[model samples]
Target chain A: MIWQFDLFILVLLVITALVALKVRDLLSAAMIFSIYSLLMCLLWAEMGAVDVAFTEAAVGAGLSTVFLIATILRTTRRTTD
Target chain B: MSDVLTFIISRFNYWIYIVLMMIGLYAMIAKRNYVKKFIGMSIFQTAIILFYVSTGVKSGATIPILEHGHDIGHAAAAINPDHYANPLPHVLMLTAIVVGVATLGVALAVVQKVHDQYETIEEPEILFKLGQE
Candidate 1:
């Protein structure tokens, strides 16, 4: 019953998440994190949890990333880790 | 062989979720930047939400919304609960999502204030500054 499309989405999700965590530039990390969030939204939608997907798209892709980038704007963008 | 394939396919989503959870856990525990830890915490929350939502899904069930034409006059007329996904988890997670946003907002504000005072967002540097004062 596993859909090929869902499997593809999961692979991309994992890759984006890892890159988001590993990237040096805070801006790049924030952008990649949005990608991760959107993929998660899609997954939840496919799973019949439309409410969760909608919330994730709004909070994760929209508000959370914007706030993270705003914080970066206020502070330095470089990270030692 | 097909039996094993079916079993793995049926259960692989949970496995993937577990791997994602571990990644977030490791990042939260080992990342040096305060923002990174915040990201990890959010990821961890997402994983838990996903797990709970998946639990409410019944195989072959549709979305929880009731059909418009269905009547409630009798036991047979009622919309069978098993025909739709369970909605309790979805309702609870609604509150969780709002709380998560508030948490992220508060966490980022704390990070901003710490950066303003110490001029650094790295944990080690913040600790160093705190130790000096």
Candidate 2:
């Protein structure tokens, strides 16, 4: 894998991870976490793990995001702490 | 200076994964909301998957599929394993990705039920309610 591209994706992954955890809005955090998953999918694809990337894109970015948003809507949108 | 740069560049993926794992752990431990904890758990699982997949990478290698394996005669030729990326971690991670999502969905469903029971998803509130009852 190209270290330059790897570094770029990794940096964004970290940023999105932190934001996902720190965000007060649960829906926003879920969306940011989906972005994190997409970045991870890109990194895996770059490293030639195509099947793994495809699974991540479909499961991590797609289904999990839908599940999280559904849960947030059914429950609460804001976090207490 | 070049040695330091090379060292850092060569192993940066591992270091970054470790950092991501720690972030996930912190979220799991410190967050008050159940959904936040669930998110942290997903982050932690993804970081571990990243590390495993990175370990399977080889320089100048193609995907794991054998180019000429479909041909009977070509299959007899000695193929160098170094030409292809490792498939083990990718396969393992595919299972892990599915398991992670399954757990996430279950955990969130439980969290919703908890919200229904306690009228809140906060750990402290739930605990306090439980203590009173």
Candidate 3:
């Protein structure tokens, strides 16, 4: 079992997710979210769910990030807490 | 002591997913920004998808596809059910991923409109603006 690799990815995913949530800059948050998505894709691939991993990599890492950046461009970049 | 460690390691994946889900839930409930909440919602959906896929896992199974030189239906008799991975969750999650992207697009459109109308994406300020107007 490659459980150690899975655990390592999970740790990074959680850390990236938390940072994406806690960061003040919307741009950084969006960038971090893409990283989170790629990490998730890697986890799924590691589990042999290649289809799910492909979709996650395509949409989560690609399309969603572009959509977010586009929307961010249309509005202000600073976020109020 | 080793038993405790073994148990934790064996079940760590599920627990990690739970922790991820909780993080998403907390963001949805307590976050102030619409975009932030949207991000949280994506995270929440991802956790659910991951959970479903995990349930379909079978040790020692190959990908759920016909082996080489095996024509569909003709090779069905020789193939053992346990040899192939579960395909149901994989198929279901394909649709879910599309839905997620479509929903994200709609939500972002709403966010844009909200910003255009009120000049703010923060809830309290938007509420204040609405009240003022």
Candidate 4:
């Protein structure tokens, strides 16, 4: 595994996670969270877990974002805290 | 100093996972919104899956697939197990990814129901309303 590439994705993952949690707009948070998942997918693929990466790309980044957005739309767009 | 730097650099993947797990744990505990809490839970699950998959990685080895298994003549060929990435953790994490999504779906549905009944998805607000009743 290339340590440099792994480090790059890992740093991005951490930043996305923080942004997802910090964003007040729930929709934005969901999008950023999906970004986090994608970075995670990249990390797994880099580490040679192709199956896991595909599953994460499909489920974690794809379906989970949709789920979060639908729930956000039905409930509330902005968080209180 | 160089030895210490190399040591940290070599195992940096594990360190990042630990940091991510902490972020998720903090969100799960400190976040007020139910949806955010569930997001935290998802992050936490992903961190765990990351740790497991990273553990399965072997440097210079390809993915866990037989290169020449399709060749009937090579059926009896000796293969080095160390030449492929470990499939056990990958398989286990596949189940984990499915379970995480299922849990997120159910949890979000419950959150929506709570918002419908209480007009708020924040935990303190819901509890406040409950305390009044």
Fnat per candidate? 0.62, 0.84, 0.48, 0.79
How far out, in Å, is residue B5 in model 2? 7.5
- Candidate 3 DockQ, CA atoms: 0.66
Q: Quantify all predictions' global Cα lDDT against the true fold.
A: 0.86, 0.92, 0.87, 0.92
How much does each candidate deviate from the true structure in C-alpha RMSD?
2.5, 1.7, 2.0, 1.4
Where does the lowest 10-residue lDDT sum fall in candidate 1 chain B?
B69-78
B7-95: candidate 3 lDDT, tens digit per residue: 98789989999989998998888889988888888898898898888777788886677685456677757878687778899889978
Give the alpha carbon lDDT tens digit for every residue of A6-74 in model 2: 899999999999999888999999999999999999999999999999999999999999999999999
- CA displacement after TM-score superposition, residue B115 of candidate 4 (Å): 0.6
| Alpha-carbon deviation at B89 in model 3, angstroms | 0.7
Q: Candidate 3: which stretches are off by over 4 Å?
A: B1-9, B69-76
i-RMS, every candidate?
Answer: 1.4, 0.8, 1.3, 0.7
Every prediction's TM-score for the first chain? 0.93, 0.97, 0.95, 0.97
Error of 4 at B120 (Å): 0.6
**Alpha carbon lDDT at B29, candidate 3:** 88
At residue A73, what lDDT does model 4 achieve? 94
Per-residue lDDT of candidate 4, residues B1-133 (tens digit): 9999999987888899999999999999999999899999999999999999988988899998888788768664678888999999999999999999999999999999999999999999899999999
Candidate 1 vs candidate 2: which has greater lDDT?
2
Docking class of 2: high
Could you tell me how far off, in angstroms, the CA of residue A36 lies in candidate 3 after the best superposition?
0.7
